[model samples]
Target: MRSEHDPGAFLDRDGVINVDIGYPHRPEDFRFIEGAPEAIRQLNRHGYKVIVVTNQSGVARGLFDEAAVEHFHNHMCAELARHDAFIDAIYMCPYHPDGQVERYRADHPDRKPGPGMILRAQKDYHIDLSRSFMIGDKESDMKAAQAAGVPGYLFKGGNLVNLIELILKQIGRPLER
Candidate 1:
């Protein structure tokens, strides 16, 4: 693994940036967690792109389609911009083996724990995963980061502040007051 001084780190979406509302598909349900926007802003200030990797199994459940998910993401971006934070990209995997439709059936590589989305981002944006960090709220998130060769932070249920301190320590950079 590379040192934390690197700039091109990545992050996950669902529970990292916004509270996971269980396959959130509605714009009204996208709640930004406390300190999340600030944390993202901090990373952005340090030259990190702040990409969002999410696994939307809702697509498989046929609750909401990809278009709806994109709409939700767009709204999220707009809200984040209000806090002077913006995501570099929002990559999602809407496929699930137990989902609906002929096409949605089966495991997808882009799904969390598979690292497909992160890999694609690395290839498309020349990201350095070895030096990057990922913040997530689930074991899948950690697994995905591991598969992508990046360190992961399991954003505990509500330990947003703890995560901030951890990142600051890992980066060996003091947080701005």
Candidate 2:
């Protein structure tokens, strides 16, 4: 199928894909949420665009830099690839209104609950927002999906792949496997 017609799975990074251990800027601190890679691989196998949208305010807080986040993502992606899963893209908000970093301190639209990142992805990837879905572990994540006119599912901390399966079923698109 053409990518332009493919729906997207907009995922939150911290709690959804990895354990939310606060400011995970280093690969050493990174830990995958149970079944995250398998869930992503299921999406990939079904022709869904698996994209990650995260709010990384740690950068603005001076806990870490953007390069650190990128490095972590690289490591995570490599691990996902080993499982035959791939993330189509990653969009993060490094800005925070009351941040410590002068350059990154600002209320940017890409921040969660703002919808800027998802909107940008919609435009860039030719995604159908009405058909797309967002998975997050926070209210802000759901709000962002609402703002972007996409359906949102909240994950209350557990096995990610199982939750994804339930989400798909609830959304009337149950996974075959």
Q: In terms of lDDT, which candidate is strongest?
A: 2
lDDT of 2 at 35: 91
Deviating ranges (above 4 Å) for candidate 2? 1-4, 172-177
Q: Model 1 lDDT vs. the true structure? A: 0.79
Backbone clashes under 3 angstroms, per model: 0, 0
Worst 10 residues of 2 by lDDT: 168-177
lDDT tens digits by residue: candidate 2, 137-169? 999999999999998999998788997787667
Q: State in Å the error of residue 12, model 2.
A: 0.1
RMSD in order of candidates: 3.1, 2.2
Q: Using TM-score, give the best candidate's number.
A: 2
